[model samples]
Target chain A: MILPYYIIIPLLAAFLISLIAGKKDNWAVILSVIATTALLVLSLFSFISMKDETVTYSMSAWSLPYGIVLVQDALTSFILVMVSIISFTSLIFSIQYIRHLSMDWKYYSLFMLLVTGMNGVIITGDFFNLYVFMEIALFSAFALVAYGSRAEEFEAAFKYAVMGSVSSFLILAGIAVTYSATSTLTMAKVAEVLPTNDQKVIFWIGALFMAGFGLKAAAMPFHAWLPDAHSSAPAPISSMLSGVLIKALGIYVLIRIFYNVFNAPEIFTKIFLVLGTISIIIGVFLAIGQWDMKRLLAYHSISQIGYILLGMGIATPLGILGAVFHLFNHAIFKSLLFYNAGSVEMALGTRDLRKMGNLMKILPTTSQTSLIASLSISGIPPFNGFFSKLIIIIAALQAGLPWYAVFAIIGSLLTLASFMKVQRYGFKGETTVESVENKVGWRMNTAMIILAVLCIATSLMVVPGIQEVTLDPVVKVIADKTEYIQLVLGGMNGN
Target chain B: MQQNDGMTLIVKTVTRISVWMILLYGIYIIFHGHLSPGGGFAGGVIIALALLNVLLAFGRKFTSEWLNISFLHDLESASATLFLVIGILGISLGGAFLANFMNKGELFALLSAGTILTLNIFIGIKVGMSLFLVVWVLAGSKIVKGE
Candidate 1:
């Protein structure tokens, strides 16, 4: 029952904001806050209810595999929680961040639409529905990237939109091929029938899906547009893009389709591993040279995503667990880092680390929170990043892939060095320019503080009881492929 | 009367006569969408084209009086909301979201296909308004060039 609200609330709020917000800018902010808060509560409730079993809702009372359905399993619930938390915080941060920009109401409306699209992507059970939601997210993100309307922003948005549309076309092509092969659009039914199909055709579909989703995920060879798009957008939007958009639209869908629908083959696993390794090494090498603060963080996003992919590539129970955990942790810390970059830009009017010095003296809250996020991202102990990285390495070794574990460690070290440059150039040195006092808004500070706390708290999920309650079900769903088919198809037959 | 703002008098005169015909055709297509080849989107685009013809013939100042961009924006939002509300009505009526609750009616009547007609009407209004606003914004931005 609550599944529909996940999409309806944000959608309704977007339209309502558009209708009334022209009269008063504050109404957009207030209404968005209320809408996001409701989403957070609903997602938490859904997550709790979906702990033990899967809940499927058939649209228009049509039987499963026929009507558009929304299925909430442990994996969907986990992502729902991640998206709502980050979006709610980003909205709070934007309350202050967007005030200086023109057309704030339009910003809010598009932001809600983006949320609605992401939620739709996460919850929809059909491939065509997924494509529709993906476009909704992509189009809104394109507009949001160009929200500043600078020449550079426009250029970046154009590049992103072109690449995004190309990827979408590839996905549609893949779906066309898939439907032709299996004669069905439902994911579980497709998965069930896919095994008996032609191996050559299956291979082609897998290749297309990998390329399509890899571009969206910003994997190594397909990562040209991310640095620009991530750096050019306003800070909160940047955080949202890096934090959840790439995950929900790119990596999560790839994992769901490949793991659940296609049943991970050895060849695809090898492809994932190679792509993951390349992105990890290349992304960091690119980051270390960047002078701009947000650009560096953007590059690091590619690198961290490489870690998650590597974990997925390992394809062991522990590996999947590590990957899922890293996905959640990255959402928290990466958004926090982007928020820090935003605060720096807000105060100093520049993103070049070359121009910044000793911000810890003035912006105590911002600096400390940034330090926490940086350490967490760099895999320091007692932070969430460390545990997830540890699990991935151990899982890889357990899967008899010591070399891959070595590559994971190498990526972590490079991440540490790159962030060290950030700490030294952006926060540690004495003020180079005459120090100007700028008052950081309480709303912005509060959002950062909340994420910082989450960075520490999420580490507790490594505990036995917590892991069982929160992550185990998701791991089971992914690792045990037959159960997924049985659950979805069985529900349909019962109906 | 030599009007400097608009196009030639012949184009203006022709547009004045054909615009109403185009609008009438658009409405016909929208209302009969349940039984016809052209539905809400095509009809809505036709309606937008009619308005665009008016703008082309009469110029900005003349059309600005009736087709205000902000009003079009509001209408787009309102129609979109109305669409969602209709979907919600299906849920309230004990069906799934977007379930066809209204009577199927006789094969091809104007009053047939309860929700489809209403939905088509909403989509036509929303699409027409959105296209109009897009054109207006693009034209308006072009006029402000040297800023």
Candidate 2:
């Protein structure tokens, strides 16, 4: 029942916002806030109440094979909570940011649909259902990226659309092959059936899915569209895109399929290791060269995601733990950084580091949050990112991959250097920025502050006692491969 | 033949009758969708095509005068909302989300599948309105014209 509502509430909010919210957009803002708030509360409740249990809801009273299932397991709940929290703050941020662009209700509607799509992806147990929800999320994403309607915005949206379509086609073909091979669309059933069949189809499915979701995740090889699309989007949207969208659509699916479904085959693990290392090295190098503030953060999103993938690729208990924990931490701090970039852009009308200077006083909240997020991204001790990256690096070394560990260490140092450049040039440059064309509103600052606090608070997730409850359960889900099949198939108590 | 006048008079005359027939046929297809191959989506496209036919034959001016854009927008939103609500309503009434809670009517009857028929109607309305609105906006946009 609760699983269905995660998608239903936001979908209803999207349609109802369009239905009721007029030209003023007051109603649109109110409804989006309410909807996201409700989702955040609901997802938090689900995460707490069902700490380790798997709950599945079969649509229309149909059983496993015929019906599409919505599952709320530890992994699903963790991702859902990440999405809800980020979306709630993003909406609060959007209230002011989007108003400055235009007092349009369409933005709110599209945002709700975006949430609905992510929630659906997280909740659905059927492969085809996940595809449908992803399409919903992407359609809105394409529109939102083009909302600014600048020539570059159009250019970015066009590039993103082409990349998205090609990935989607590959995914669809993969699904077709999977279905033909397994004779089922339900993921658990597919898991049960896939192993009994030929291993070659499994390799094809893994490769296609790796490339497809890899593109969506913006892995190094398939990362061409990400910087443009993520940076070209409106600010709150940029935060959402970098923070949760790629995680939900790309990394979460990657983990679920490769680990839970396919059970972490050696070849894909090697593929993941090479790709993750390359992304870690190359993404930071690409990030180091960016002058555009949002573009810098966007490229860093690629770099940060590299850490998570490396953690997953390592495929140890500690490594999966690091990946999951870093997934949460990156969502918090990356979103905060985007908020800083957005606020700076809002205040000064430029995203170029050269154009920005001495904003520490003028935009105190944004600057301080930027500092926390910067230190967090750079793996400074006591912040969440440090612990996760340390775990990932340590896990890499422990797993007998010292060279990859050294590369990660190098990536971390480069990241620190890159962010140091940001702090020096973008926020604390010698020149004083005098006039603010538009002041950063309280709501935007409040959103930034919320994430900044979470940057520190969520690091507690790795604390031994708390880790046992929160991060440990999720890691257990990913670590025990065939357990997902039993947990999902064994728990089909639909409402 | 003339700018914004649409097609020739002969074509207009032929479209005048054909458009209404298309509209009627689309409704028939949508209503019969639960039992037939052509469902809500196909029928809705047909319904939009009927309006598009008028646009091509009679012109933008005539179509704009005859229909309200905002109303079409509202219709689209309302039907989509109704479609979703109908699904949730099935759950509230008892079984599961999107359960066919209502009594299944006689086999081959016009009112057969309980929730599917209602869902089809709503989806039909939504798709038809949205498609027409999309055509309307694209035709009207300066950016689309590259001007």
Candidate 3:
């Protein structure tokens, strides 16, 4: 009962708010907060209740493969926590950020809609249902990106929409082919009936999904639209898009479908590994060259996502654990990083690194949090990023992939260089422009500070004892897809 | 109105009928998916085409008024909500995500076809509505030239 409400409440709120948004902005903002807050609480409860349990709910009381299904395992619970936290923080950020906009109502309404779609994607059990929710998320995101209607924003939104639509079509085509081949739509049913040998049809379908999702994930070859989209979106939106949207919509679906549904082959793992490596190396190099703050961070998002994908693709115990842990860490630090960037832009009226300097004295909270996020991302000790990267490196070395470890280290060093440049040019220098104005909003500082705290607090999950209880089961779900099918069928039988 | 309005109406009618044909064919594929080929997504594209045709033929204002862009927005949100709600039913019943066919009453009948049909329709509405809305907005006068 609570499971469905996690998705439905947000959707309903988005609708109701949009209907009345024209009349009152305050109402929309309040409703949006209430919706996301409810989700945060519900997801937290689901995490606690399902610690040792796997629960499945059939839609409309219909039976399996015949009726739509929603499943909540340890993995879903973990992702649910990530989604709600990021969304809640971003909504709070939006409260102040949207005050100046002429279309404040549209902004809040679309934000709620995007959250609704993301939550739907995370919780739904069916494959085609996944595609539908993907559309919801993408459509709302497109509209949100264009809400400002500036020339650059419009151009960016158009490019993002076209690429997104093509991906959607590819995904739809893949689903069509898969349905033809397996004669089933339920993810578990496909897994059950899937042939052992590699079918050409399945290979094509897999490629299509990878391309479709890869574009969304902003992986190396398919990542052209990301910098433009992220940089052009409003500050709070950029935070959410970079923080959790790509991971939930892109990497999460890739892992869920390929690993669990298609039972990905060795070849697929190799493909993912190569793409992850390229994204890390290329994204970091490109980020180092950028003068714009958001564009640089956008490039880093691609790099960090690569690390997550690399850990998961390695498919070793330590690797999978590292991947999941890194995902959580990335969500925290990346969102914090974006908030800091937003604050700098808000204060200085520019995101160009060359135009700004000496922000340490002017905006202490923003500067400090940005430093923490930079250190965390650059894998400094005591930060959560260090442990996950270390685990991934060790896993790579153990798997006899020494080159991957080398790339990971190199990426870390390059990231440090880029962030150090940021510190020098933006925060630590005396070349501050006299014309540069600074007005630090309480809302901006508060949002960045909270995420900065979350960045450090989440590091405790890396502790061995804590890992055993919280992260281990979720990793286990990925390691054994067969258990997923068996559990669902068994639960159905018993129910 | 005038002859120009009559001509425009004729064009829209032709486009609308063609879109319906495509949509109906897509639905045929979705229903026959279990034993033969095609499924929710293929059916969805067809449905989207029908809506797209309406948007294209009727022009932005008429389509927005007829489809009610705001109402379509609500429908789109509701479809996704419904999709998730349906999936949660499996979890509440103590099963996995999308774990359908619990009772196994029968396999071939229209009502007996199970969750596949329901999933198909939900996806159809979601895709159709989203795609149409996007096309409508892009083609609409709301899009400023420089912007």
TM-scores for chain A, candidates in order? 0.98, 0.99, 0.97
Query: Model 1, range A89-150, lDDT digits (tens) per residue?
Result: 99999988888667479999999999999999999889999999999999999999999998
Which model scores highest in lDDT? 2
- Model 3 DockQ reads 0.13
lDDT (0 to 1) per candidate? 0.90, 0.92, 0.82
- TM value for model 2: 0.98
Over 4 Å off, model 3? A196-201, A433-438, B1-147
Task: Judging by lDDT, tell me the better candidate of 1 and 3.
Answer: 1
The pairs that clash in candidate 1 are none
lDDT of 1 by residue, B2-21 (tens): 37767988898899899999
- In candidate 3, position A394 carries an lDDT of 94
| DockQ metric for all predictions | 0.76, 0.83, 0.13
True lDDT of residue A113, candidate 2: 97
Tens-digit lDDT track of model 2 for A230-304: 999999999899999999999999999999899899899888888989998999999999999999999999888
Give every prediction's interface RMSD: 1.3, 1.0, 6.2
Could you give candidate 3's per-residue lDDT for residues A235-268 as a string of tens digits? 8898889988899999888888887777767778
Error of 3 at A282 (Å): 1.1
